[model samples]
Target: MLMDDDLFSSRPEDPLASLARQDLDPLSQHELDERIAALEAEIARVRAHSEAVAKHRSAADALFKR
Candidate 1:
């Protein structure tokens, strides 16, 4: 049976943070490792998005500057 930790994690300032954080005491070392991996993946995704948005904004500003 899949528990909540198997289905969820805490990180990245998402709507998940609006909800109460789950207790970490019940997690095993393996589960904590998995959570770390998930958060890392999310960080990469967010960085990529930020980079793209910054590039687009820069281009827009240059266009308007001309």
Candidate 2:
């Protein structure tokens, strides 16, 4: 019996795709908690970067329109 590839291969382009497909059954409670903290931190970091980029783009558009 073979495991379905789709079970782990969804959205291969996603940065967190591999983590999403990981088996959490082998992780200890402490490890799972740590993983959640790490993912949260990463989400914050990505959001901040996105906001910065959007701000820069808006500023550039305004300057070009003037």
The TM-score values for the models, in the order shown, are 0.70, 0.74
lDDT (CA) per prediction = 0.85, 0.89
C-alpha-based local distance difference test score of model 1: 0.85
lDDT of 1 by residue, 9-46 (tens): 55445667743487889989999899889988998999
Tally clashes: model 2: 0
Clash number by candidate, in order: 0, 0
Ten residues in sequence with the least summed lDDT for candidate 2: 6-15
C-alpha-based local distance difference test score of model 2: 0.89
Alpha-carbon shift of residue 39 in model 1 (angstroms): 0.3
- Best candidate, lDDT: 2
Q: Model 1, which residues run further than 4 Å from truth?
A: 1-14, 18-20
Cα deviation of 45, candidate 2, in Å? 0.2
| Residue 22 Cα positional deviation in candidate 1, in Å, after optimal superposition | 1.5
